[model samples]
Target: MKLTAASIATLPPRKLPYPDSLLPGLALYVGAKRRTWLLRYRSGGGKQVHDKIGYFIPNAPEGSESLGLAAAREKAREILGRVEAGVPVAEAPIHHPKTGGETVEQSLDKYEKYRTRQGGRIKSLPKTMKALRSALADYATLPVANFTRRDLRRAAEVIADRGSVHAASAFLRYAGPWLKWLVERELIETNFARDVSKPAAVKKRKRVLSDEEIRLVWTAAGSMEGVRRDAAKNYGRAVQLLMLTGQRLDEVISLKYGDILDGKWRLKGEHNKSGRDHVVTFSKTALKIIGTGEADQRVFPGVHGKISGFSRLKKDLDKLSATSGWRLHDLRRTLFTRLVEDLDFPEEIAHAVCNHKQQGLSAVYNQASRERQKAKAWEAWDDRLRVILATEKVVTLAKPLTGLN
Candidate 1:
């Protein structure tokens, strides 16, 4: 009358759509479509009538029918058997709030916490959560498991309507991972979202500006409106470094006075993305931009309000670009390309300034802590930058082309 693991394994295939499990009087069924696996368990408190245990699946190759029916009855038995044996599953692993009702907001909150635990980038987390929040507004009332591609597409449409294929794409990307996780944990069947396409380009268009544009922007900065002032200043510097030194935006912004030593900018343990010390050589321009002998909390602290204000910088830059016809990110792109193509900086050195790990031995085997030579490279870049900046001028719409010419 009691079930044994061997007994369950030995049972005959009941029909075309077979019940894979047998607990004496109980039955566990795998679907004919092979869509789902179900385990029928007899209630400890009740009669011969059976109740469903749960689901599980072996990970299968993508796009295979195996994944569709991946959750098998025996796997459910292991989990239920463990719980039944008085091994308490963690009080709340992932989403565990027992609720008469659940909302998308609640699930997303749980997911955000899980992501933080996984060491997902904190700066990116807020942006990711903001997108999820926007997506959930129209769909929050619906069950997360019940969400369909149409629903996802509708969310995508809304993002696209906001003129952002990128945000729409990112939402779908993050959503799929969370949905797949739910599938893996037996919180759901195969993730319906496993097939959704977000379609972002593998390589982003570098948005850094050309030497000419840099000159145009610098000339444009002084005469720009109040809102554009901060943006032009921060981005001007950021763009300069991005082109000149190849430092990431954050690395450039996170610089503290103490971090600079011997005319070099040193990234401390707190700020380096690589989680290692990074030394940025003081190119004459980098030094001139950052090296006011007077100590302050930050070099670009000239922006109004908000200490270490990146958003303010972005806001101002956006305002200026709307009028002047340029975007701040373009500056970084222009810089990366110039370093790679024009200045003859090695690909690895260019990537190093961005704090991107150099690939292959440059990234993995070499474990190089390139300090001295990198400094020289940036300094050389600075020397060239002065020549470029000195040559061109940014002109405003109010003034004719002849003014700059």
Candidate 2:
């Protein structure tokens, strides 16, 4: 029977075949629920093959036809034309032409484009790709298919030899997934970086700044001069917020004015590192440091994007404070440590303060979120910061952190 929109819509669900009268080889296979349009054709060698044209979806919104009768017949004609032209049938269903002589740079570009199309938008993808290209500069122009285990190992070795084990590790982390992506797409035969041993573990940083050092850095954050003064002050405020909240530097810097609402900094799961919602209560000290900005403006605007140029600001901070070898991340650890050692927060409360996920048994059984306790803890921490900042010692409930003028 010749199919129409009404006939296709009224077709009952069954494992039945509907042959198109207009196109000899085009047919629809109606399985339990889905009906897929397929082109039944023969290769030059006369081997019969069935190629999926599209799905026969009924009542699709206008302009989004997957496989209407007219379109399916047109697609079947195109497939048959290609078959008649001696185009070999693809061995794999999801076949893409192999880039046998394609360079690493080209492969990276294709990889990025593929990922973006697949909705895998990673913020660090560009920087990571650039770093990997730098590490493999000697072989970047070489064909991706020609890379072996030795080439990947050599890349790691060269990065390690430059006195950055972390960089070497990061190179492997970026390369492994990228090479695997190529392998999955049949651009390369093997993912050589997959089995390569990771570089030796570097010593973990334990350089927590002392209270005096913290005070020095805090004060120095304001005294920066020339064109960098504003940027420095911005970094200093970010540092203060990090210390007060025990959140990551990126989280603080990426904070939009909208994130501060209802007397708390609210981060949805997508914005948080833990992939869970996080709410940080504001304190008087935090409010003072956040200051006033437009509702759409960033709390700390520095450089091109959210509060960059930390390394340059850190140099000035280091020089003025006469403190060395401290990282911004260490401030998170410092807050956790002080919360326990100085403020007498319980171990679990300290962990909660840092937003670390509770592990094992506690995570499953403990349903209470301790929101009130957290508020009290932040209040205590803010009071301590006021003492350090030499502001009024009283800790009060904070209004909206952004008094945007």
Candidate 3:
């Protein structure tokens, strides 16, 4: 029988003999207190299922009423429409597993955060990310699995053509691991980075500063002017600190006032490039250069973080010193060279000052720390720098062994 308001009310609590003819699968479900409409049908998968449409009543009172025969038929028709379209229309929406969905940009962002959680230094990763994004701009929206070996080779070639073999190599170093991580998670079948060209060859830089260059840089640092004078001053001091301590640029810039204690700068393991704690004795001049800052605050504060505006400051330093073809890292090499050659400091003591890791059996057996010896060496280095700053005449020194010979 066709379902109608009059027919549905008189229907006893007994089970329906058959479904209504008006709507094929629509039926009035009689219960102890209330009546309800249930639509039963097979889905596209050929499995039978039932869905509750709405409550029914003999007489609808005022604004709220029972689900009438017309309403039940309409709702059933809508659900059947969804089923015919290959959707599983049930009481609740079905959730399916995501497949090949994440884009390259999305994966890269997630990988960056993962590295941070794993205690990896993210200082230089952004450059690599930016380069990759620019090179793979066409593939930003493509799924991570869609990236191919050809993509990696093309990106490396693009970066290398810009005249930085080191940056090209750095791109592979940063991107390769993240792609491998995706493979480990089963997001992709394989790492295309493995099939790409290996990191480009890099010529080790040997651009030590001469005494005349140091003197010129020291004077130039003090004489910075114009709108960016304050930024230049901070970068200049950081450069000088790199010269005095031979520490990594990031470690020196990230120094807090609390790191200074008992005439030593205590560098935490997480902040050091070697992933080990380091303590360096500061000279009187070094202390003066550091000056005073809030105990919990950065020793060299910048607009974004500690000590920025590096490229501009470096250009100015180069112009004033009449120098070319030197980077900030050369300052560290200059200090290590000066300690071993000019000051007659032992090679082992110099390595300790630079926090270089030992090799072979020496790494495990040699626990001998020459803190006092390293302190004296720093004092001697400070004395030498002061003498260079005091005079325009270039101080000549005996050529140091490059170890290449």
Candidate 4:
């Protein structure tokens, strides 16, 4: 029998059955606000399922005795008309996975697999997935089908409550792609977290160090204990290169012996965000840092257990920065700012040293392999660094290493 006003009133909150001829497939009653209702409907065999269609607001003429009841009837009639014509309807509203909910996790796993298989240069993939795992570890055992937006908001609150804006941002960012994917795949009804805003980027308020500050930091870092000492060595070399060559730390640290072909360091897509190869010519300081290592050797090798992480490295620097007063990355920025601000190095050559893939057609066509000019540029930089280091006597951090580690 067709679901009518009196019939719906007598029915329970959920699983209120309706006639297939009048409606279509199974209709399961969900929630309501007096007369308005949210329902679940499924089409075909078990292939297609939808959660919510539209609200059942009481469409009363003038006044009605039972507003909610009258509205339910009208809404039912409209939904039934659409179903009978075989139009697809919402099965459920897409929501954030609840505490102990795996809904978003499932979506994310599939997305990751697709991306990996597609062979994209996802250098940050591991970091992104690690954040997702950490955020949803507690909800791992929960069913994927029961995720809701309320749950997601609560999770974000919990993370923010713990005073971790960075962590919260990480979780939210990782969840975003998966949420969009679910919406596209019709996994949930709609993406509730789609409108969720992300945290603002940490400002790069830091600038390159002045000559006086550079001496102080170099002196302090070189005088420290253990890995920071070696990190200081790498730091020394990297700083000199940065000053001379003007490359970012990420691009410089990833440099290997093999990449140095005919006096050029070639950074592959695997090491960079830009899917193009970059060529950086080493300065005399950069070459000295290279120091006769095997072709595949890393320019800077951390000790047995020092994590290859910026945060970890930052903490180490913070402790030393008290005496040195120079933030670690400022070394790179110092090089950039000095070249651009003080020395007036061409912006193209400055960016080229960092292996920054420029934007638009210019980035593609204006690729100048200025290895000769770069070499000359870096030679000038080496002389500058030597003058600073010798004058300041800044290489005695910790016990003096007879040879580079």
TM-score per model over all chains: 0.60, 0.65, 0.67, 0.61
Model 3 TM-score on a 0 to 1 scale: 0.67
In model 4, how large is the Cα lDDT of residue 36?
25
Candidate 3 Cα outliers beyond 4 Å, as residue runs: 1-99, 120-135, 192-195, 198-200, 226-229, 357-369, 392-405
Model 1 weakest 10-residue run by lDDT: 60-69
lDDT of 3 by residue, 1-405 (tens): 556657887777766633678778877787666577888889777888877777665533212224567777888899889888977564664222122478778888888778777875565666667766766665566566656566677667777888877777777777778888899978877877767765566888988988877876666655554343355567767777888888878778888888888678986656656545678999998898898777797876665576666786677666765666888888888898999999999898888888887788977787766788989989999999888877857633222112110
The best-first sequence of candidates by TM-score reads 3, 2, 4, 1
Per-residue lDDT of 49-163 in model 2, one digit per residue for the tens?
8887777655442223345777778778877888899975464353222223687778888888876676533646667878977987776656666566777887898889988
Which regions of candidate 2 deviate over 4 angstroms? 1-99, 117-121, 226-229, 357-370, 388-405
For model 4, give the 10-residue run with minimal summed lDDT.
57-66
Per-residue lDDT for 220 in model 1? 48
Clashes of 4: 15
**Candidate 4 lDDT tens digits, 1-405:** 555654544444544534323444434353343322434454545444443433322222112122244444466666656666777654455332222334445766887887688776787787788877777665554444445565566566567778887678678877777667676877656777766554445454576566655665555444433444465356445544555666666666666666687667777756677566666666655666577677877666555322155554444444444434455556656665555665567876556555566798976787566655555555655666667667744432333333233
- Relative to the true structure, candidate 4 has a C-alpha RMSD (angstroms) of 12.3
Collision count of model 2: 0
lDDT of 4 at 265: 76
Q: Per-residue lDDT tens digits of candidate 1, residues 193-242?
A: 65666644434654556666665555444333334335445444654555
- Please rank every candidate by lDDT, starting with the best: 3, 2, 4, 1
Where model 4 places Cα greater than 4 Å from the true spot, the runs are 1-102, 143-154, 189-194, 199-204, 221-251, 304-327, 360-377, 387-405
Q: How accurate is candidate 2 locally (lDDT)?
A: 0.72
Which residue pairs in candidate 2 have backbone atoms (N, alpha carbon, C) closer than 3 angstroms, thus clashing?
A: none
